[model samples]
Target: MNQPESSKSLFLGGAAKATAASREKYVPRMGEESALEEVLVEDVAPVRISAFVGLLVAISSFTAAVAKPMLVLPVLAIALCLFALRKHDGRTKPVGTLAARIGLVLACLFGSTGFFVHHLKSRTLGNQAVYFARQYLELAARGEESLAIELQKTKPNRQVATMQLNEAYSQDESAMEQLENFRSGAYVDVKKAGLDTEWELDRRPRVFQKYGREKVDTYWRDPSGKFNGVIQVELEWSPAYEGEEADWHVSLFQVERELIVAPSVL
Candidate 1:
């Protein structure tokens, strides 16, 4: 009545296969907990903060490029960064988290630089214009009638020319008041104009004569007595790119109307 050995062995083998199948179908509770921990580590990685900072810097740079009175933007940006850091309790986040801080600094630098450049351009343009005007008077003094006449023919709004010329006189007088010997001139002459006055050459005497979509001004001293000019100046500030540099130009002229024509041009 005892079971055959082969049959017993078969029964044991069947039990073992059933046990393996059950284990495969079941998941360990501890393993599930470990998987969740791994997911959390990935989700809270510092890379998230860095990516955000990169985006902030890009936006800041773009705004800085267009905002007028730009000096204020950088200040505001800096203030915002400090506020954020304070809210975070001064904790050091990822490197990208400091993008705003760096952006603020760069904004300030670029804004200041642009302002100074414009300021210098304005000042130099005004002074040079005055110099050419005064030089016209000097040319008149030396009987260089043709050159002086040519100036009037090469500028915009004769009235503007006269004003700039007077401005030069005022500048010289102001320098005199300061006990400084200053020699300068301003000139205005129509280079090219149309019914609507498409172009002009003002604030000249420090420019050159050239052909383009830009305004140019220059002051030249007629050497070899051919013109008896005092200062040979050429200036072209405005540019013409995609019609953006419409404020740029090239102008050339001679300056000689100086009661105290300094030994040289500064």
Candidate 2:
């Protein structure tokens, strides 16, 4: 009976030792797993934040491309994305970098395209303004008074007509006759002293301004290809009746003769 009890006690003691060894190994493994989980949780917040910021940058870039006025927003977004990317590391770095790059490319493309279109439109309008000015000046110089007057925003009033007549008849005895002819609503022949009726444009018209109104300057040359004078015309939008095509009409016309000075022999 004593021998059997000793053997059973030894066996129970060995089983206890094995159980303790297994617990020691399992506890360390559980602790290690918990630490790893804590590390992952700590990393998640930063990655999420970076991704969110990157999404915002992309959206702003797209908006900037569509609406040029919103370019500032995309610039700000790019700055923010860069800052976020700097803070990001490991798995999040690539995502943040990609977002920032995409935003930058889209912003550049849309912004440049918008500016180019705007400049092209301005150039086209300027060309139109210059053409209108040239046509008006051509008609006036050719003594097509009725056709030239049609280009005016409004018909010249009596006061304006009288002033023009006075300027045209400033010198010579025929001035009195021409003034009488103008008052009688007749086309006074001032071809000899007035603008050269046979002049043609010698160079591209210089556009001074293009907005609600436009001003254009053009140089003219006589039949001999000598620069005769400069013509400036101001144009404004004509009144649009319902369903009528939009148009511009001449608001003012001015001509300046080229100065002729004899060379002094030195």
Q: Which has the greatest TM-score?
A: 2
lDDT of 2 by residue, 8-127 (tens): 999999999999866553333224436532233223334335545655655655555444456666566656656655654444234456665665566466556655654665576567
TM-score of each: 0.32, 0.46
Q: Judging by lDDT against the true structure, name the best candidate.
A: 2
Error of 2 at 127 (Å): 2.7
List candidate 1 segments past 4 Å from native. Answer: 1-86, 89-96, 139-146, 155-266
Worst 10 residues of 1 by lDDT: 190-199
> After TM-score superposition, what is the CA distance of residue 96 in candidate 2 from its true location, in Å?
4.4
lDDT (Cα atoms) of all candidates against the true structure: 0.44, 0.54
Candidate 2: list runs displaced more than 4 Å.
Answer: 1-96, 154-229, 237-241, 255-266
* Candidate 2 lDDT score at position 123: 71
